[model samples]
Target chain A: MNEKVAKLYQERLNRYMTALDCGKPDKVPVSFGIGDWIVKHTENNFQEIFYDWEKSIKAVDDILPEFDVDVFGGGPTLWWPPMWDAIGSKLYKFPGMGLDENSTFQFVEEEYMKAEDYDAFIANPTEWIATTYLPRISTEFENPSSLRGISALIRSSVAFAEYNNYMGASWGKWTVEHGVVGQFTGMTKAPFDTLGDALRSMKGILLDLRRRPEKVAAACEVIVPHNINYALSGAGADTRFPCFAPLHRGSYPFLNPYQWENYYWPSFKAVIEGLWAKGKRTYFYAEGDWTPYLEKIAELPDKSIVFDIDLTDAKKAKEILGGRFCLIGGMPTTLLTYGTPEKVKEQVKRSIDELAGDGGFILGAGGVVMGDAKKENIMAMLEAAREYGTY
Target chain B: MSEKEKKFVPEPGTCTPWKVKMEELGGIPGNEEIVKKDWERLDETAYNFLWFWVHR
Candidate 1:
């Protein structure tokens, strides 16, 4: 263990934790949501890098340090293909499944949970995921009927645990070795998001929200505990960065304020409150534009939640959220990929000026860096943070 | 791209000390065309997945 290397890692961790604490650090912490873009940028093939931990390590190399941000990324965030294959998934198209060799994995949105089956799902969330969801998606578990899908579910869980351990250790090593903290710990999907994303597709959830509102609400109540469990289960909880919960499908376009406040938000809030009660302060990736629901978002206990949001103006987000929650991103992904480095720098500057007040902002893109995102622009974003982000 | 301001440059061995060439970070020279095609197709799916993690 190199003393200086450990010191660098500590320094970066403190910078990230300070920002997460809603206090100004020496500089604004920057982390890119670069997912599969790393593999695409590298000469590595998607299948090899996506599945093999060593291959992914080689694929990502020191790209994180090369760009040099306060926080590290390009972790093995992708769920392994073996699990997907075991499930015989129709939802995602990996490198060879439905996509070409060069592209990142793609997800296809389709209904997996039906409206009428809300009670069955709510009856036992784990059982529903195991018996109902698993068999529906995969051929192997097509007969979870025999053991009530308990065996298959157990196997899948075991596989996930093993795979996650391997990937977590491997990717986590790179982040630490490069003297950077990762972007997130655990990923707990907000209950409503869990419904919309995992069980029900957008169409299904939207229709359920309209026709069977109470049932949808009931289902989310059951999902809250599961979300909390999943988030705290991430490997790096003991470190500087805690876990993260992702709230999805609650944006204005999908649901009005009333719908979001009622159906989507309560369970999501429960996930936050539940995790907080257990002494875990997790970042909430408030997916989609949160302009309509910033007030509701502000109600979370101060400095206990990270409101890493998208599409909303940083100035307004700061005004609304800066007091309580740390803001994680402001640079738009499109701008990072398509615009020049100067434009990227300007965005970084504005975000720092607006959201980095006394330090409560992590400077980065609005969403996961797309495959096409220019590295120069990302470099510029980090450089801009150093220039304008100093406290 | 701007004047070198007083930024927090890490001490020698402060960052990734065994610094590999920046290119080792990965860059596909001519794949910009593939990136474009993949970009257009994945734009909606990507954002959609961001909001909906329905992918297995």
Candidate 2:
């Protein structure tokens, strides 16, 4: 990196690190993401951004110069569809392949792991995943010993490695050129989500909770260690940045407080504690209303998480989680999509006022901004964050 | 393979650990660290691959 870029990088990194530690910096750090919302602004379609690595970086490159933010969360296109296609994977329907070119990817959730398989999974989770889960999820891998199934595994694994290499290089370029500090190093999930998302599906997990509660708990307990390991391994054991944990099922209404406390919170808390033990903090991406569970979440160690406020009550979050943890997100994602630029700026000002009083706050949109989110609104948000974010 | 052999569960973050592989290989004649390093790297890659499905 050049001397100028290095200085800029240090400034941004210090700003992010300061806010994360719940300490006041010279200014309130801002977190910005290049979501699918950027597609409308660019000439490239969703398919191109999702499939071609170069195009994805270029799309982000086109916008980085314009937006001045402390941390870049990353682009909307999370996966390379060709890897899924290589295995004839039925996981997601990406744009151009299954939907229109302009459309976003869709996850096809199913009960890939049957209820009966709980014991097997608990006994030997990794082996069970390799032997049973792979065959069930990928069409080509139905018969693993068969030539097609074997080849599919090889092709997809190669694609996974290829994508990782490309992303690592892209991130390096972004940091060197744009002096943009990355949002998080590694990725993980709540242990319940590790099962409830792709393996059991929402309906299946809920059914298991009623009929086979003990089994559900056991499965989640088994997932706890693995989730910690995954988070650490995924980040290459980097503790400098927090690991992204897009928490699911722990939010309100998804699980009654009783079910959440028993089945979800134990294993989820274990994962966070395990990461903390290893000197890693989790980026708690709480996407929905978690007002009911604020006290339980606060049980975590100080500075163990960067709490995200999406649909949750922001003022209450500040009141409860304010001084203890770094609080991010205040502008509601809906306001970005439906509200005007004027409203966006207002929300930014309001979020900063309510959340950034004490030093532990980063101004950002609450949750994933969708394709319909307006570019003008996003720009307004970034501009306003700077205008009002000064401490 | 016996039922006991079939139930050789690997540790978390590993599919076939170096210890398990070393046991399977009986004994290594060459430098073990070199082989172990590559083995663990690939094991991590495979672990990431398996976990990728659910994380999505």
Best candidate, DockQ-wise?
A: 2
Candidate 1 C-alpha error for residue A62, in Å: 3.7
DockQ score for candidate 2: 0.80
Tens digits of per-residue lDDT, candidate 1, A1-391, equal: 3787688777778888888888878878877645666665766777777666677676565475576776765563466766666545667787755677666787777787877678877775554554466577665567765674556555655566577567677655775566666766656767888888867888898888889899999988876765665566443344345575656697667887789889988988888888777767777666677787788888888877877767776677888888678888878888977899999888877777667778778887775666777777778887888888778
TM-score list, all predictions: 0.82, 0.98
Quote the positional error of residue A284 for candidate 2 in Å: 0.5
Per-residue lDDT of candidate 1, residues B1-56 (tens digit): 13422223222112211122123435566655565555443332222222222323
Off by over 4 Å in 2: B1-6
Q: Is the docking of candidate 2 incorrect, acceptable, medium or high quality?
A: high
- Write down the lDDT that model 2 would get: 0.90
User: Which regions of candidate 1 fall more than 4 Å away from where they truly are?
Assistant: A145-158, A235-240, B1-56
